[model samples]
Target: MRFDLFHTRVDAHIRKAQEYLQAANLARIEHQIAADHHLALASMYAQRVTWLEQELSESVSRFSPPFRGVMTVAAEGGKRGAESVVSLQRSAPVSNG
Candidate 1:
C-alpha cells in the first residue's frame, strides 16, 4: 500500500480508538453494558493501531539506511553528489512485495 494511505488508515484507527474510549467513559455511569461494548471496540482498534504501527516501522526500516546515508551526505554539503545517493538506493534490497 502507498505510505500516505497507510498513514491515513493508522490515523483513522487511532481516532476510532480514542472516540470509543471516550464513549465508554461517558457511558460507564448509566449503562454498564454499553460501556463494556465500547471498551471492547476501543481495545480492538488499539490493537489494530499497534499492528499497523509495527508494519509501518518495519517498512521504514527496510529503506532507512540508504535514505539516512543520503541525508547525512547531503547535510555534509553534498560533496559526494547525487550519484552516491543513486548507488545507495540501488544497493538497498527490495523486500516489500
Candidate 2:
C-alpha cells in the first residue's frame, strides 16, 4: 500500500479504538446504573441483579472480536464495582430520591 493509504488505514484503526473506548465507558456507566437500581430494590434485588447481568452481557455481546477481549475485562471490573455499590446500598437502606 502507498504511504498515504497505509496512514489512512492506521487512522481508521485509531478511530475504531476510540469508539471501543467510548463503548467501554458506556458499559461502565450502565453497570453503575444497574447497581443503583439493585440498591434501591434491596431485599427485592434479584431482578435488578438480573437486569445488571443482562446489561453487561449485552454490552459484552456488542463488542467485536477484535475488541471483545479487552472490553470484557474492563466490563468485569466495572461490574464488580457496581455489585459492591449494590451491596452497600442493601446493607444500609437509603432513599432513592
Candidate 3:
C-alpha cells in the first residue's frame, strides 16, 4: 500500500464530513419524532384531567342546582379531545409514528 499523507488526510476529512452529515440527518429525524409522537397521548391525558376537574367543580358547586350546562360542555370537550387523539394515532404511520 502506498502511504500518501496528503491523500490519507483528505480521506479522513471526507469520512468525518460524512459522519457529521449522517449525525445531522439522524438528529433531524429524532427531533421531528420527539417523544415518538406520544404528544397525542399527553394531549388526551391533559384533556381528561381538565374534564375531571370541571366535573369535580360542578359536583361541588354551592348552588342548589349544579350547573349541568358547564358539565355537559366539559364532557363534550373532553370527548372530542379524546376522539381527536385516537384519530391522530390511527392516522399516524404504523411504525414509530
Question: For model 1, how does the per-residue alpha-carbon lDDT over 41-67 read when each residue is reduced to its tens digit?
Answer: 999999998997677556656775666
TM-score of 3: 0.46
Q: Show where candidate 2 strays beyond 4 Å.
A: 1-8, 43-97
- 14-87, model 3: which lDDT tens digit per residue? 99999999999999999879876789789999999999887777675754332444454556675543223321
Q: What is the lDDT of candidate 2?
A: 0.72
| Candidates' C-alpha lDDT | 0.72, 0.72, 0.68
* Residue 70 CA displacement from its true place in model 2, Å: 55
Q: List the candidate 3 regions with Cα displacement exceeding 4 Å.
A: 1-8, 35-38, 62-97
TM-score of each prediction: 0.36, 0.36, 0.46
lDDT of 2 by residue, 1-96 (tens): 545744457777899999999999999999999998878788567777889888977887886553555566566675543223321126677789
> What TM-score quantifies how close candidate 2 is to the native fold?
0.36
Candidate 1 similarity to native, TM-score: 0.36
lDDT-superior candidate, 1 or 2: 1
